[model samples]
Target: MSVSDHAMPIGFLTCPGTHPGSPVRRDDAYEHDLQVDALRPALAALGHELVEIDWRSPVEAFADMPLVLVGTPWDYQDAERAFLDQLDTLEAAGHIVCNSSAVVRWNASKTYLRDLERRGVATIPTDWAQAPDISDILFAMEKFGNDTVVAKRQVGAGAEGQSIHHRAKLDPLWCMEQPAMLQPFLPQIQSDGEYSFLFVEAEFSHALRKRAAPGDYRVQSIYGGMEEPFEPSSADRAAAQAVIDAVPFDAPLYARIDMVRGSDGGLLVMEAELIEPFLYPTQGPRLGVMLATAIDRRLCQ
Candidate 1:
């Protein structure tokens, strides 16, 4: 197909269709599909087709599409080997995959925290151990010397596998047997809130400041957090840019940098979501348009 024709047929790979946070089997995902339906027309208006595919589809089917945007491959993280093998096969067969598979693999594990730490990005003090030992937990408690800390699965998403516990309340036996991350809970997560920087291609698309409504620490909207449009300050913009530039893999078609303030009032990295992050289109009016344009460019390439 010609470049123009190719631009008209961009494929949007999302999860099997359904409502987000609904009770559904992981193997038969539908929530992501439902979201893509809403996002489809926005991309379609820009002159591109949005093709939805299930994880069960053969990778070869997408080889001819100009771009395969990974909209909501939530299941891909858990089954990395299968997911990555498909991506590899597709790329080798000359297909373009947005939010590059390499980046997906790296970010899926959440262990990327260590990689970023090595790069000098300020992050919460963290320790990870598999099936943690009670003694190890005790040691970590003493090591960090924080009264309260967060215990969560290594690959947790959307507050899944997350729990807050005081040192006295924690069970050392539970720590010894689960793959988890232990880190001091930031009181600032309740104070100043978190900043999520959204980017489309290399441009700073928009940003939002998220804060839990009251008596909560999770800033996810699903957890009743409130998000307000934020105009990143010059310093904030620079900080966001630094992170974008630091991405070791290809620039993702989309990314959201989640950061928070520390006790000392300095910014600390919370999470770098290159996968399917909730882009608040209502808050950031022009972002959808900007993102559509970028997708068009990728499709035509």
Candidate 2:
């Protein structure tokens, strides 16, 4: 393929840890490379150059790029305000940001699940707390009538600060130190596994089932989880689609609807990952082309 003289540059916002050759790069940083490798070639074919730029870089560094994808800034949760400010700055400069700042702000907090619930999307039962202590955990457990429960940060990703507690193993002094969400621990996460439905430009691209390692509840790759391609039934697909339909904004450039089966045998929204969810391109080989095509359409518009 011949390189175009006027290939447009598209920025992919990554974190220092996911940047190539960073000393503090994460163990799972390979996922960043995999995502870039999948999209780069396809973008090149469309005369768009995919440039990996660290999200923390000076705002001026992004001036040349007219479009930016909120790629893998996996540590954003640790410095969420700064990360969001950067995206807002980019948008103010007239740059197109995939899953725009508005979407980012809405999805930054897990509380967005409440919005989905109000909009008629089925979500796991959760209790919101400013900072949950043992009492809060006990209350949530009692409300859900489950002996085991999961506690997670309201603003978090990759299950970084997540913990599971059981009545038998409860600790009196333990608490989630930040704003938290408490939910009954679903056995389905271990038995049937979690499902991820990948969408590009609001269209279903692929689906996968993610299973955690033995004795673990998190299905993230860093937690020793594995994924297998899944062909969802029509009902399952519609369930996932309902989440997309409920999103208040126009369809984002990309969305990952993570779900788990409930005790009632229906899927519940785990998260509607709009910010920087790993698209699992390996399982969805068409992801690169699908995204590139979507980007091209956006550019044309």
Candidate 3:
């Protein structure tokens, strides 16, 4: 496809800033992803234009674009209801969201793991409590039967509300009005690392292993985490495929299946990232071309 043949521009969403936003906080460790640089040239090669749009801005800002890819609105968790509402408005207004609004809303919270488990998809044992109290925390401990526990806000990222401690340190007063999910602190996250399978148009494209920084358990850059290319085993691919098969949407534009090996030596879903996950790697030949090709095909259809 030539530039002239590509008649539509892509709106790649980014974190929104405050009105005359404050300067970056000194202690803020957020590493803004630079996928745009790779995406622009790659998209241009496929004859599609790329534009960055603040997801916090009014939907009218980019509603005119043919495709609005939810690139990495990492802050959407801050105002989840409003964010999902915005997606509703965009889809209702005839804008095509790459992963679709339904998928976004469902994937917004970590509770999706429960749904996956019910559907027979292998998922790590997780227990959720709404506006939890002390009793709820205690129950999760007894239920998971683990000495150390990992508790996280239902809708959070970058280890924002993650607390790892012995059952004694858990404060039921922690999450106010917001729900939370609890899991056993899997040692493999530090030893074996988490496997992430990237899929485009529901087709597996690449895979990587994200390892947390030494002495840390959160595998995000903010926590000094690092990732390296990984080759998924046959069983690993099957596990990811099963997660894909559980999606209600026709065919997802993109997906990241994050999982780890449980004590019994089986892949268990750690978390499924269908909304705004950074899809490209820092070192490898980028996946932008594959993404651009997918976008082009969708447009032509």
Candidate 4:
């Protein structure tokens, strides 16, 4: 397919809090700029224009866009239902929502891991609970036979509302305020770090390893975590691909498969970030070109 002669505009959806000019913008909002810088020129090279728009903007504002990429709406977790509704509305109006609303919904909750596990994708052992209390945590610890456990909200991002508790330090009053997933804490996180495999249109793009700060276990940049380009062994790459294949849906426009090495020396799916995952353009320099090419192909189709 040939590139269009005219520069068609593509929508890159962000939230008000992540917009550059927002008074309440997040400190990590610079990630939005980095991604834009990476993709804007590449899209322009393909005779396409990238428009940064707040996702909460009126529906009419997106009428002219042929495709909308679910970009950095980091605040979407706070209003997940509304976010999903907006995507459904845009898709219904004939704008191609990359990853699509269905994909977003399937991925909105961490429980999707269960689906993948059912499809034979290896995942960390997790106990799902509704607003787990101290008793539940203890049950998870006993079930996994591990003294340390990590508890995270079923619907959250960037390590928000996450906690780590050791058997010795267990707080009797501690309890999750929302539906949560409890898993034994793998000490490998501090040693080997977590690996991220990026895919565009289900094709591999690049890989990176994210390590937490000295005293933190969260690998998100907001927690002072750092990442570097990584060359994955073919076996490890295949492990990540298995996750994509198990997605139970058509290929999304982009995906970030985050994994960690399990005790048995195999990678376990940590999270399959299909919605608004930071692509780590710095680690994957060709990300823009690959994504632009894929988007152009989709547009041509």
Global lDDT of each candidate = 0.73, 0.92, 0.77, 0.92
State every prediction's TM-score relative to the real structure.
0.85, 0.95, 0.87, 0.97
- How well is each residue in 1-301 modelled by candidate 4, as lDDT tens digits? 3467655899999887788798888878888999999999999889899998999998999988999999998888778889999999999999999889999999999999999999999999999999998999899999999999999999888788899999998899998778999999999999999999999988999999999999989888878899977999999999999999899899999999999999988999999999999999988888999999998888877
Candidate 2 vs candidate 4, TM-score winner: 4
List the lowest-lDDT window of 10 residues for candidate 4. 1-10
Q: Which of candidates 1 and 2 is the stronger one according to TM-score?
A: 2
TM-score-based ranking, best first? 4, 2, 3, 1
- Tens digits of per-residue lDDT, candidate 3, 38-60, equal 57788888767888777777877
Q: Lowest-lDDT window of 10 residues in candidate 1?
A: 1-10
Off by more than 4 A, model 1:
1-6, 17-42, 176-178
Candidate of highest TM-score:
4
Instruction: Kindly list the per-residue Cα lDDT of model 2 for residues 1-301, writing each as its tens digit.
Output: 4444556899998888899888999888999999999999999998999999999988899888889999998888878899999999999998999989999999999999999999999999999999889999899989999999999999887787898899998999997778999999999999999999999877999999999999888898778999987999999999999999899999999999999999988999999999998899999999999998888778777
**lDDT comparing candidate 4 with the true structure:** 0.92
Q: How do the candidates rank by lDDT, highest first?
A: 4, 2, 3, 1
The TM-score, computed over Cα atoms with residue i paired to residue i, of candidate 3 is 0.87
Candidate 2 residue spans exceeding 4 A from truth: 1-6
